[model samples]
Target: MSFYFNIATDKTVTADQILEALGRPEVSVDDNKMIFHIPGKSLRGACVYHSDEGYEVGVNAFTPKTDARLTRDVAAAIAWLTGASVVPEDSEDSFSPEYIADYGGEDWVAERFDEAYFLARRPDDAAEGGPLSVAGYKRTFAVTPDMFEQDAGSLEDAIRAVMQVGIDLQTLDDREDIFAASLMSFTPPAAPPQSTLRRMFGLSKPVSNVREPYTAFFIGPDVRTLTPYNETSDPFYVHLSVDQKAVFRLPADDFFAYAEAAGARAYGAQVYDITISQADHAKLMQQAEPA
Candidate 1:
């Protein structure tokens, strides 16, 4: 399957210009496809030179990681050459030479760009082991009135701190079998009067009722650890009864909508969706945490 991005341009350019912009000279065309591979990368792809009406480029899937980079490179090349921007034919996302520098990894597609890019194609299939067998990834935390005495660059950064907590929890759970899903979403703000009696009694935990942003991203097939029924059990308990998956698993695309409604209502705080890759995570951590 070939993933395509459309480049809309008004500049009068020739096929030679497009090919040159591709920074490649080794190319051949047949009735099937124009084979051209980016230097030093296992990119299997073709290009459709732009007409006055704009043109498209596509790549046969090599790997999600490879394909994503190729998609961005070709699109960026075409956009740079034509002095225009590129948008995925499958999504509304538009990227110019400037934004082209944005990380276009597979994870970034779901985290920062349009999730539709991945959803349009079986993105998980691009991997060898395939995506984890999880229903999704989730993170829920109370957005304290302050970043607990830390300087949160933005509310979003504060949320990232919480998202990191969830990632750490699952990574230690099943090791490599899980914790591969990207991060997404956060809750709206919430506030409840601090209890006078609890403080007077020296109880010192922030109220859980505070605006607790909770969100789960169903990026994979399994979200929870399922316990199978076992016939052999201790005499104190039934052998057949075992714990089942309990993680919040929802494949619906309305995570943000749900966050909005829940925040506007009661109990649940507003949830804002955020999507990020492991590289993004490292970048976040490399920066000093909110002081």
Candidate 2:
């Protein structure tokens, strides 16, 4: 792994000054971020940190300059060297009200996180038969700050971009059978304002024919609940199969609590915030596979 030093200054500061301050004179500069070589993993985002006022530093698993590697360390180094604090940056303010509002609020921003995080919580196919047939799919979009702003600042559009990007990549890989062979990274570019998401893969519309116990989740204002019959079930669970030997049978509330905890454990991960219905629960349990 490589090491780096970064300094964020409200007032301009030179790269040489930063290295001198850190007592490491042999540092190299890259783009806005800088780098240095340490014996092993050192000064990574997870291990090295500076306050909002000071510089942040870290070591990354990837080549800090390339998408091939990203880690807590790289995040730190970037924040420090570029003088760009991580979005929702502070640990103390990790799950704060502002934090939740920016990411977990109603609209598209919240939805993407909801799918990556909250949605992933619903039980997976932890059964004996193939992956316990959870029959629903997630929509991902490739979004940017500008695109989000243009959609009347609706986060839903951003979410759509991610879904679109994911779909496109999925299709390319499926059709070419080359997705698995490349040592490339699929970092979706930041969505542009008034941007159009090109569909990559998956059904353009919901696949009604493959009906299964399913649930849907979204980030929106007003705690919208999902009823079994409601056309728009926020988190509607789908039932498709059953597991004879269930490992952990948790109540709905407990299940959600577990999911929340799991989401908190992941850094730089998106979690969706939404409500579900009792009917959705029934569907989720319909094909219950215990791990």
lDDT of 1: 0.41
Per-residue lDDT tens digits of candidate 1, residues 134-185?
A: 1111222222222212464653444344333323332233443433333334
Candidate 2's TM-score = 0.18
lDDT of 2 by residue, 58-162 (tens): 432211121112223334334444545453332423232223324322352232234432222324342222111111111122222332234354454544443
For model 2, how big is the CA root-mean-square deviation?
A: 21.9
Q: Give the per-residue Cα lDDT of candidate 2 at 30.
A: 36
Q: Which has the greatest TM-score?
A: 1
RMSD in order of candidates:
20.8, 21.9
**Which ten residues in a row are the worst by lDDT in model 1?**
233-242
Clashing residue pairs in all predictions, respectively, total 18, 41
Q: TM-score, each model?
A: 0.31, 0.18
Candidate 1: where are CA atoms >4 Å away?
12-16, 22-34, 39-43, 49-52, 62-64, 106-291
